[model samples]
Target: MPHPERNPFVFSDARFRKFIGSVAAIGAAALVLVGCSPSTDQGGTFADDGCTSVVVATSSEKVNLMEDLGAAFKDSAEHKGLEKCATVHAVNVASGKAAQYLSDSTTEWALGADTAPSVWSPASTVWTNRVASIAGDKVVAGAESFAKTPVVFGMPESMAKALGYPGKPISLKQIHDLIANPDGWGAAGKSMWGSFKIAKTNPNSSTTGMSMLLMQAYAASGKAQDLTVADVKAAEEFSRVFESGAIHYGDTTGKVLQNLADRTSGKGSSYVSAIALEETSLYNYNIGNPDSHTVQPGETLTPPDEKLVAVYPSEGSMWSDNPAVVLDAKWVTPEQKTASAAFVKFLHTKKAQELLPKYGFRPTDDSVDVSKYLNADVGVDPKQPAVTLPQPEPEVVSAAIDQWAAIRKPSAILQLIDISGSMDESIGDGRTRLDGAIEGSTATLGQIRPTDEIGVWAFTTGLSSNIDGTRVNGIGVVRPFGVLGGDKEGLQSDIEDLANSQRAGTPLYDSISSAYDYMKTHAEAGRINAIVVLSDGEDTDSATRLDTLIQKINADQKEGGNDKPVRIFAIAYSKAADVESLEKLARASGGQVFDATDPAKITETFQSVMNNF
Candidate 1:
């Protein structure tokens, strides 16, 4: 476990410091990979270059641990009989994004800088299998695991105790029943806790989300493994029931954890009752922080006032075996392959493997003790993960994730887009900010369920007439709230027309209150009722105060009845936009905010936000 050998490149060394601070680019050719350079010496080797680089791409969650391991491997004098010097460089990327690069050859993942990875360490093997299916013979099967962790439900201590925590084991069925219960948490004698809300990540984009959906299917069939297409189809009712309580669906579990930790005490219901995330996330949350991006070395994390305890569902759960895979792509050189294998072997060493426990992960190396990390004080049970679910066929896993959006509850949404003067500003290419929003809106409309009801309202300082010359509150009603099944065309046209219209001043507060009240009154059951606000400016004309609006939303959300919950999804449209206030507004009703500050990302951001539905 001691330092292998003094790092050849010290912190004080210019080359080491420069390489460590390099940023990984997105949507462009990022030079973060290592490629072999031709030898000039008589032995056909470039030993003078110090070592050949074996660049690795690690899943976001494992970035911190992998960074430590990579540094150690690079500094090690000898690793598993490898004779040549080898440098290991680690970069963090989303598992899904990494899989996309491996599956497709034309993808310029990281050009010029580092190139394609010699090794890929995703959070789970699910991604490995997926990439293999797409790339055929290009992927090596059964990669070695360096760290082990499982998906778990993280709930507030008070909420877990209400469901019989220490004495009784909680089941997935029990959680689903709570979601289906008319009185929500009140059914468990906690009316003030309001309705049961679940914060989950997007299945199409997040590993935790994929595992959560699979677990629900397995739980529904009363089986822990061998989930078939039939089993997934049959679980529709269960999936629907469970997803009904979902208040937010983000791209990462870390964001959800941060939200829970933020509103833990007096505002218990501001975020969610529970989050379906990695056990590692729960461990991190209880230790006072949620995001590893902000974690500083030697900084002691302060525990939250209300700790989050991990509840291993009685049904079963999947382990995220952080697998280190050496891809068999054409870009991988023989020297790079050897170096990659050496690094993998080095990862199994006690020195590297022992770091897992400190990061809330179960070390894959059996020699490491796990008892201390899984104690009650850390919000986990040492012996409670009794069932380990099997990884279904890759096809089945894909089907289960693909079917989730279709089977989950429908959404009834009111899109309140800003048409204030700021929207008239150009976003380049002879297009205005409003033009970008219109493009995004049109694309998103195509993805919503046909049976769902949707409406569009354009707001500015003063009210205006509709395309039909009809006026309401001096504002324009582009498309009246109605079923998408019959009015898709009209709605699409109205959204386009909003691009051409312009007005003065941004009446954010009044527009939000009006939309919230309207949606609440016309809220549909068995559907996600929401008010989505797309604004590029702060409140300029409104009688309602921000605090008053927040109180109103919180009260409305907790009023408990047969009516569906109404959430506010705010999009801060530009850099100068007031995101802080928008985020507060969104979280007030247990909703989430999406950033569309960059004009180039407008379409993708809008489409991504719809993943919550």
Candidate 2:
């Protein structure tokens, strides 16, 4: 089907070239990237000058695409023809967070600016459905898909070939069978590769994860459409079995793909055998841009030695139909609404649709051929995923989400905090770095499941007494591992008390090593074992070397025959924190490092880290 002819505005080749040439001159002045802030300035810089500004809050993966489109729209004659010239501004916001912001008017909208979005375009329509369900249908209007990509299991080329991928129809049931087999890859005669570990994101926090969840339900029900609440319940066991094979859950697919690419460089394929992510992500990984960030001009990409192939589940899969929705909120003015509609319409034009394939997305315009980009060279088959699953009703989706919380893999986590003297230094608002971290950690406790095991430990040089009065060196257990259901209140209080215990030097190296040893020793078999380290600075005093700690972590995370996997998630809490060292520790353990260098973002950062479980 050809793109709908809704907007009469059309640009000829000469006019398009003229518009493109003028973009460099006006793009900078017109585009305003908004971040999280509490102030309410719905109209941006253009508002003061009698110009309409349409603020578009979009998912990170498509920020670059939206920014480019925004710039082009700004330069278009249609925009100039408006009674009041308009500027289209694009801001990067995660899909899940955007839903939260939209559902609650009291919530702060942007990070750097006070402006709320006039238009919201998340990676999938499911998010819009969620917002409409929570805030009513009036809140989300005119949701039109502009681009699409199906969710698929991305496996290493060798592994996919072993399963007869292109020749044999691989289904979710087949993958589940492999995971259920105690022999793992041994079932396929590849005894060298141990357990078949899979990587996925937390459904509550990711689009691909949410889509994967829905697909799993459909696969379990043996239907592609009209999935019911009873169907979700009946599939509970099937979903649980599939989830048990997960290596670990995260907030984004980028980290998993990046780690997989890094492992292929030298560390080998011991990290994860397969990952459930969008087809575009697999294409990006095959082209050596796992994170999927826009490649700049003059940038050279080095493809990984072990490229991944897209495995479209024979049971049927769901597509992330990137949709642009014009919100009908009180904050969105009439002029802004008109401008937003124009921009969304422009996104479907030939010029805009032509750029979609270049960015690893399938264009909504059927006339635009995607064969060149989605071909075997990038490890994706353009003709596949022959089956497309429909989105379930909002009620069914809500039920699935609730059911997922009960069946998802539980966690065994240790929170390691730095109470060094430097943490006492003020970071505006008369609050110290330790205060921010404490507040963030306390809030994170609410997000944890009751069945998960959690604990807290504070570290500073010469700390001899723990909360329980046990003697220790540099590290003191504020609370030992216990089920969150019974220990949450006490854990929150202990984490809060950490702010008053700041003293002495930072024994970062020794403390981390100690935490790793403890968690590894107590690692649970059916749960994700992890250590979350939040430190404000580098090691001021420690006998352990960085290389030595890295070697220890790598040895335990060996490619074959390792059962206990305790990942170490590091958080650089302030500008003074040693990001490089923390990154090395995280990478060594097949984990991720989060930067909370701006102390104020600690709460948000902490929540993101907890999503790994």
Candidate 3:
């Protein structure tokens, strides 16, 4: 049941009160499978065929859990009541991607299932509510939450202790105070910890990150709920300050959690000190599933040596009621709907509900004790998270998402493009490797804010190289660094020219080292400094050693004490590209490595890398 007191602010608002009253009336009735029907009664009678298969589309975070539940359904005897063997097929789709599929049923990825999905279980009800608002009665008309978890700061136990956590609830205001201080955690006697690197998903792409944004809005307004457009506007400065501490913004929290788990010590080696995550993820981490990837059948989890503790903010936080919605799409048959309902019922069963605690989730069934799973050993307090922030209307969430890019930390990025002879090869789409790289990269420039400092570099071995008196191994720079405000067109022209240039051997090593040196020499304060390199070939003609270049890059990063370290993002362009070396370069600078091996994904992959800003 939705907490009435915790959500009072949303209910009390005049607009929301009216909206909820009308929506609740629709939700109270079980809608039919046929799309856009005025009647809310979903009751249907169908002859049991003795066997039915239902496809369930789930969010990435719950993929493993859903798989386990699916296996359980297949082996359960309680399902005999339907006189049908219900085959539950679970597909893991990211929340934002699933939202898109719901909007456009013709989406290519959704077609992978033998039949259309009968149910859609995103990580949070926020998504269920979103689909309802967009598609109206034609989409998810009703949903049942199976498990409950709240958003919390997942940090190493030692760091939490230093910040007075567990003993005291850490507030966002306290976090902001630390971010504002240049000394970072060093002000609190932990100088080696360096800057307070926080990790969060891009709000537009993630449920957990979206909840974090709401928390920030409430913190700025000093309210537990009813976040307004005015509140979002007022919170812009605070949001920027808070966002400045983010080392990287991924599409999901798994990457951040995995990075934290990789280094058990949770010191300078770890990319992030704290990450915004659902308690389920922290639970999974403590149990040794760092990546939280899909789990195969009969697999047993091996707990990790390092544990991540949840720090519920004193200001307030949001609870994710992981709702499973039986989608009211045209493809859902009466038999399938009945099967889906059975599966939902099975999830609430005592046996199935008992599995929730073992996976670090609070079961929705009242019979299961929340205390059994919520304990300090796994890094959560059974009695805490006393406050649940009220959710604003969906429109308010949309507004906050739109405002993020404007208030996010500015970036100083240098994109290094490789124009080797191999780039002239075809990618089978009537587009050459160079052409795809140019077109894809040019499109990404538009997403960069005008205030950001940007530049373009195209490197090939024998092209009036910039090795004059500089380093003995400097590769040619097609275009130098320029501010995007006035040089956007010029940079685009340079990118296009790369496609038309006469190809030469790739100077991968020298070009990378030279670009790194250029950015390091011109590193700007108060902005994220980064280098994005797209290469389709290995070093064919370069005097620089890969190890030596990596050493210089790592050494230069250490020179700037607490100055935002310059990160390198590498895109391994094709099958023949050297991914292992690129991964090394990216990891050396605390950045990410993106794969664009499929020619078709070049544009999308480049855009994904831009999300880091």
TM-score to true structure, per model: 0.82, 0.89, 0.83
The Cα local distance difference test for each model comes to 0.73, 0.78, 0.73
> Candidate 1's residue-wise lDDT over 129-150, tens digit each?
8887887745756487888888
> Cα RMSDs of all predictions?
8.6, 6.7, 11.6
lDDT of 2 by residue, 304-415 (tens): 6666889999989899999998888777779888888888888888878886765579999899988755678677888989899988888888888898888888889999
Task: After superposing candidate 3 on the true structure, give the runs of residues whose Cα lies further than 4 Å from its correct spot.
Answer: 1-53, 77-84, 104-118, 263-265, 268-270, 296-306, 328-338, 370-374, 465-479, 486-490, 556-560
Model 1 lDDT at residue 353:
77
Off by over 4 Å in 2: 1-52, 75-77, 106-112, 264-268, 294-299, 465-472
Tens digit of lDDT per residue, candidate 3, span 12-98? 125423432332232133211111111111112223334576667776556556655655665554565566567565665667667
TM-score of 2: 0.89
Residue pair clashes in candidate 1? 30-110, 31-113, 31-114, 33-114, 463-474, 463-475, 464-474, 464-475
Candidate 2 vs candidate 3: the TM-score winner is: 2
Question: How many steric clashes does model 1 contain?
Answer: 8
